[model samples]
Target: MRWFFYFAYICTMETKTSKIFGLRSVIEAINSGETISKVFLQKDLTGAISNELNGLIAQHNISRSYVPIEKLNKLSKNNNHQGVVAEISPIEFADLDAIISTSVEKDKAPLFLLLDGVSDVRNFGAIIRTAECAGVDAIVISKHGSAPVNADAIKTSAGAAFKIPICKVDHIKDALFQFQAAEIQTVAATEKTDNLIYTIDLKIPTAIIMGSEERGVNPSVLKMVNAKAKLPLLGEIESLNVSVACGAFLYEATRQRL
Candidate 1:
């Protein structure tokens, strides 16, 4: 089944391909290190095959949507979609450790961006775009409570997601400890503090934490941070959007680094 899928994929001229028809074929694509952007499951799907597909999607952190059979059929162009379709990517993820090691080896202060519970794909993509523009060493995100790196995110990032190193951690606090142990100061961006972003000296090795829109930073992660700062707001609005805040923080760091 996998061979058939691969043969079909090889014969196609399309730069990107979507898998359809069988459950195992989609699973094989994921297991074989194929870049799955998204997966669509028929709304009424159940039984062994459905269970297995669900498990694989969770394991690989693949974004999925429950849709009607008609939707899947439409997506598969009236082909034998078999209640599933998976979108493949044209690029791959970067090595997290290599990004950090290279930054230190070059005598560069490690400028890292940590996103805590940011679920919006557009926001995540926008942040990556800014991080790449500001020359961030890497972006760290928790395995859960973050946006999946799907095709929409990649497109919105203008391919910066492929260019940037994105580290997925199980526990954000543990990752913060690792960065601190490596001599990187962990900075959290919050409206709770009075310290202006410009006042913080980002010339040193730094890791900036940007939180979610509704909840802000998780308190457990907040406790692990070395310092907390805020972007001064003169307008009636209290805070900035997460992505905009991230860009402001990163570019401020860029200024100090220069």
Candidate 2:
């Protein structure tokens, strides 16, 4: 009788454990476009649930990991996690046109940061922190080449991601055209320019374009810029990292405004 009870208890525990392990809850979160920090899946678990989870992660650009079942178990604190867990956040995005209109209506100079092909989430977050500190009105990024505004990005921004306006656009060129029409001077930070950043008057309505570390600004964006300026390189390095360059440019603008 005692032996039978022990066997039944073991079966019940195992059943409860399996019920809680894996994809159902995680898939629901992804489908909602929730800010998923990370997703973990049991290694070698190939099933309907895993397939659906993988498809959703890929479609939404959510980061994921295939880990041992024990890892998932540990994460869930022995809850029936079924073999998957996802960390998420409550981050929000700002509307692009609304930000632009609000900045202009306030009679502010509308100091803006335009990021071209900057894929690194850390860099994106750091730039946002600096831009907020320097009183930039908004930070614009292209939809295709930019990093997703995930939990890591929000944390890296020191909460500035929530405080500052971020504009995600379909085509950077179209956004540039709108800025130009609004009488906002668009300046590209490029090594190709002979003019230095300090020489340009940022006190006026300005949009500063900072490009990617690998490719610099897209050629079309470079051509559309009202002016192209470079930070004078006194050091041996050819150029500053994108985030550092963004800070320098922003502070220079701040100084001019002051």
In candidate 1, where is summed lDDT lowest over 10 consecutive residues?
9-18
Clash totals in order: 0, 10
**Residue-by-residue lDDT tens digits, candidate 1, 1-258:** 976764554444233543545688898887888876678899889899779889999997876789998888888888887789886655565555666667777777789999998999889889999999999988988766677776556667866887888887666786787788778899999887889889888999999999998889899888889899998899899888999999999999999988
Best by lDDT: 1
Compose the digit string of candidate 2's lDDT tens values, residues 1-258.
976865665455334422123478888877776656567788887888788888988887655678898888887888888778876643555677787788888866888889998889889889988999999988887756676675556656766787887876766787798789888999999998799998999999999999998989888889999999989888788888899998999999999999
Predicted candidate 2, C-alpha RMSD: 11.9
TM values, all candidates: 0.78, 0.70
Q: Would you list the C-alpha lDDT of every candidate in the order shown?
A: 0.82, 0.80
Candidate 2 residue 192 Cα shift, in angstroms, is 1.0
